[model samples]
Target: MKKIAILNGPNLDRLGKREPEIYGHTTLADLEASLRAEFAATTSLDFFQSNHEGALIDKIAALADAKFDGIVINGAALTHTSVALRDALAGAHLPTVEVHISNIYKREEFRHTSLTAPVSLAVISGLGLEGYFAAVRFLLKR
Candidate 1:
């Protein structure tokens, strides 16, 4: 089976509750279940979510060392702020796709820039949970 890691950073664990107007009512667990059910037959999935930058960076390193085929990451608040996370992703050199529940382009000015985008295979934003599915499907095909 092809291995893919889905990494979520900062405030994403509050998916259903944090900002329902923008993030929707679906919890992270619900999203995971949806992804697992959709791709379980053909892909081996590893899901990790953290509020800490170091933990997420550590996961990127571990995934790279383990030779994961691809990654789907929603860096959340870290997307614009963490050069360390961006560096980790770049260093990993894994085929990575960045995801966002809301369109970062439509949000606050700071959210518009993503340090991780330059190193990713693609970035899927504004599609809600579908963005996650899209990222996984794109990676699976790649």
Candidate 2:
């Protein structure tokens, strides 16, 4: 099975309860369960969520060292601001897809820019949780 790491950053831990209107009502655990159910036969999914940037960076490095096949990351707020996170992704040299639950272009001006997208193989936005599935499928095919 393909090994994929799903990394979520910052306030994503509050997914279901945090602005249900924009992010929808799916909790992080719910998302993980759904992804597992959807891809369990073909992919081994590992999940990590962190409110701290260093934790995320460290996890990415660890995933690289462990030879993970791909990464699906929802950097949340850090998507717009963290060059360190972007660097870590680039350095990992793994196939990566960046996922955003909401459309960043449709949000605040600051969100229109993603520091990590440049290092990602693709960016999935505005498609809600389906974006995560799409990302995993793409990576699996790759």
Q: Could you tell me every candidate's TM-score relative to the true structure? A: 0.99, 0.99
- For residues 1-142, write the lDDT of model 2, one tens digit per residue: 8999999999999999999999999899999999999999999999999999999999999999999999999999899999999999999999999999999999999999999999999999999999999999999999
> Candidate 1 deviates by what RMSD?
0.5
Q: Where is model 1 poorest over a 10-residue stretch in terms of lDDT?
A: 76-85
The weakest ten consecutive residues by lDDT in model 2 span: 101-110
User: Model 2 off-target regions past 4 Å?
Assistant: none
TM-score for candidate 2, residues paired by index: 0.99
State residue 85's C-alpha deviation in candidate 2, in Å.
Answer: 0.1
How much is the lDDT of residue 112 in candidate 1? 95
What shift in Å separates residue 83 of candidate 2 from its native position after superposition? 0.6
- After superposition, which runs of candidate 1 have C-alpha atoms over 4 Å from their true positions? none
Largest lDDT belongs to which candidate?
2
Query: lDDT of each structure?
Result: 0.95, 0.97
